[model samples]
Target: MSNEDFLENEDNLFVQKRVPHDDLHELVKYGDHPIYQGLKDDQSKAWIKKSLFEKLDYQTKLNCVKEEAMVIALERYLIPMISENQETSYNLALIRICTTLTKGWFRQFAIDNYPQLINLDKDLLSIARNVIEKFPIKRKKPVLLTHDPETRVIFDSIRPYTEILSFFDKLEYDPDDFDITGIKITSPVNGNISVTAIITTLCKYNFSCNPSASWSASVIILPSKEMEIFLRNYKSSKYELISDLTTKYIFSLRIKANTSGTSWGVGEDIWKPIYVEAKSADDVASILEIPGLTGDLLFKYVLDFLNPTLARNGETPLKHWVNELKSEGAIPIKPEQHLWYHAWNYELKSLFM
Candidate 1:
């Protein structure tokens, strides 16, 4: 049977579930058993159980419980029943548990946050590489993701929206083929973002409002018949068109508008995104509303009006960037975890590097 079918088969003997509280009476009857001492630096059984209870995240906690359950189940039942030679189903369940746990762990890992992993030991790095291999993703047909870790994880869980998403794992979209649409802010927006304009597909597609769909706010109506494609993708699916490819770490994007014309704003001294000057969301929507903007000298109205200080280049995958450090034999010191880890999920800002 396939992996999914086997996992669903209730007729199979062993699956990872909680060992009954009543079942633990058997362990206590053994009285200070050596088998129980093997947990977490030989801590007392109570301490071991407490540690598992304290774990956060659905999968991590489940993994801990499954591990403890397996140990007890093997010692109490499987080993004793060895003479019966009916270990195949039990062994399969245990193996599946480990495999499932590992994939879950990999999904949760964010390589960019841990700068220390730039130089992993050969043994550990091999396993890390293998886990990444299990999910092969191509960067082309990129989806916009949030910089916020909490929101990013939520986005990651609902990924591959294949109905709405255009995924090309190996082949890439041509950068030359993709340019900003002609629609740009008509009037001076100044610094207020809520006034920024947007079109169909998303209403709360603002950085100030819904951070998850903010990418739509920026690149409204990707030009060409592609707009029809995007609109069709948007209209027909319940799934959101955008997705976060990486769980918590993705490469950044940097582009200074390759300008067509130059227009001086009312107060041009301040430097911010052209979207900041938007009078309304539709004004922001107008930035790329129409199709076919070959910046060539159409009117010279669309200026390369970007802050010179902004990073000119876009982002690279953390894996690609991190490997360079490994090649250079760098081993960074571990950084402290955030004190308020989930606090930034509500922050309002464009997700730049």
Candidate 2:
């Protein structure tokens, strides 16, 4: 199928529900029938058992739960069972019931708020990568680890860590001492335990914020298994190591005010709090390295970057801007816009070397 066709089908399968009034009422009435009466009557184990069986039978007779209310009831009753049983029928039923009741709420939410959803997905991916790097697994090429098909979704979500490890491992020079080593460690100490350490270091160095920025950097350290173990245990307060190899080539980035002269407001001195002038399309294009940054995207990046500063300075009536860069369409959006607000404030010399 064409991409549009596939998306349309997927949307139909997952979008939110809009039911007819009379049909919805009938479904509610059916759910309230005596046979299914006990489903909502009690909260204990015996009540749950009775409710599950009754709802199942009621749903079976109707060929499905018709009302949104019934769908919710079925979800609460059945999701636990499917999660535990791993039965194909049960899983399918749960998916159907959820999709039916939600009217594809999850899918619609994903579609309507694609940008926000993408950001959240990235955060989840980042967390997953951190978890994998912090907890090393010794699966060699000679032995491929296999998981149950049912758990494939969980596995795929975390597979980025493997790529992250490979990327870090390829960085031969350490950022700390400039020593050449094939291995890249994420922590200053050792092992795969430095998640907390790296985060702590980032914070100690003044780079912690709610939605902190991140970029890649490298550091060299002594090569020893004990050191590895120590680095493994290192945990930073806010910054996290994306990989668990050598401390080189760590991803780090941050957001800061556009403290440049142009952002200042009228009558606002350079020292006074003021809005930074928006970056030209050329400037933003250079920084982002995306040829198609439209005027709007450049405005977004600048505004987003300066959001915290604006809030702090009590800037009012915030305006978002967009500019077109010659003819390259819209500038490519930054994947990690959330992290742009919390920046490291120390001088380059103080933090490195």
lDDT of each: 0.25, 0.27
Residue lDDT tens for model 2, 1-353? 11121122111111121321223224335334433334444421112233354346433423323232233322322222222222333334334434332233322432343332111111222322343355443332331223344334433432232211233344333332121222222322223421111110111111111111111222222223554565568675212333443233122222122211111110111122222211123332233233344333433332232232211211111111111211243322332232221122111212443
Q: What are the per-model C-alpha RMSD values against the true structure? A: 23.7, 22.0
> What is candidate 1's CA lDDT for residue 338?
20
Scored by lDDT, model 1 comes in at 0.25
RMSD (Cα, Å) of model 2: 22.0
Rate residue 226 of model 2 by lDDT. Answer: 50
Best by TM-score: 1
What is the TM-score of each predicted model, taking all chains together? 0.20, 0.18
